[model samples]
Target: MTEKVIALDIGNVCIGIHPERCFGALGFRSLADIPREVLFLAGERFERGEISEAEFLDGFRRLTGSALSDAELRRAFCAIIGEPVPGMAELVSGLAGRGYRPVFFSDTSVTHMEELRRKFPAASAVPDGIYSYRVHAKKPELPMFEAFEARFGVPAFYFDDRAELIEGARKHGWNAHRFVSAEEVDKILG
Candidate 1:
C-alpha cells in the first residue's frame, strides 16, 4: 500500500509570520539598504547550516553594523513568527486520524524553528519535520522534495502556502495543494 502523507509548510500555513517583519525590526528599510544577494547569501548560509548562529548574527552585524546584543538580535529575528493558524491543531489531528501522516516541511532555520516550537508546543507534535537548516535545501527546489520522497516514498499529498512550492511538488508527480485556510483543507481532506 502507498503511504499517504500530508506535508505541511510551517510558515503562513501552520503558523503565520509577516514576510519582512524580522528585517523591518532589524531596521532594514528595504532590500536596497542591504543588497538582495548579500541577504540571500547570509540567509542561505545560515539556513543550510553552513555557519553557526553566532556567525550568522555576525554576518548581519557586518552588513548593518548594528550594535544589537545577541539577545536583542535573537529577539528581532524571532519577532516575525507569531501564533499558530486558527484550527491548525484540529486539522492536523483530523488528518492523522484518517491515516494521513502529518509532516512539517519548512524553509526554516534552527533559531526560528526553536522559537516557534517554544511558542507553540503543539507544533512539536508533528511526526517529522524536514527543516532547511538540516536538509541544506528549501522548497521549490527538487532536492528538498527528493530527500522527502526518499524518506517517505513520495507523499500522497503535499500542502504549502506558496504557489511556487506547490508547483514544484507537482512537477515531482505529487498531489500538491496550495493551503489557503484550515477550513478549506479540512473540507478537501475530510
Candidate 2:
C-alpha cells in the first residue's frame, strides 16, 4: 500500500495563531475588525489572482470600516493560533520523511493567506497543490477532499482539527482523524 499521508492544517486566519509565532512587532486582535463578506470576497480575489496584498487590505478596510492598523490585526489573528499544537508540524514532517506526503488544506482568505505565506515555511513543506480559499471551496465540503484525492491519490490517513470535516472525510471511505496532537497521530499510525 502507498504510505502517503496528506495532513491538513485549518484556519480562518491561520493554522495556529500562537503569539511566539509572530515575527514582526505586533499586538493581539481578533477578526472582529473584518467582515465575513469582506474576507470571503478577499478569498475569491486571491483565488482569482486579481488583487495584490496591499489591494486586499485596502478593500478589506473599506469593507470593515475598522481603523485598526493591518499590522495590529495581523498580530491579533496570529496570537489566536495555538502554539504548534504540540509537535504537529514535526509529526507531519516525520511522516513525509518516511515516504508519506503532507498537504495543507485550508479555507483561509487571500489577505490572511498572504500573511500565512510569510508566517510559516509552508511553501517548502507542502506541495503547491494545496487547497486554500484562493483555490475556492472550503473544508466540510466534499469537493475539496475530492480535489485532494484527485491530486494526491488517497492518503494513508487524513487528519484535520475539525471533527465535522473528519466526518465528511470518513464518508468517502477515507480513514480520517480529528487531529488533536502528535500523540493522537502516533496512536492512529501505530
Candidate with top lDDT is 1
Q: Model 2: what TM-score?
A: 0.69
Local distance difference test values of all predictions, in order: 0.79, 0.60
TM-score of each: 0.89, 0.69
Which 10 residues in a row give candidate 1 its minimum summed lDDT?
Answer: 30-39
Highest-TM-score candidate = 1
Q: Which ten residues in a row are the worst by lDDT in model 2? A: 19-28
How would you encode candidate 2's per-residue C-alpha lDDT over 74-145 as one tens digit per residue?
554345444344565566557656776777767655555555556554445765455555445666577777
How many Å off is the CA of 180 in candidate 1?
A: 0.8
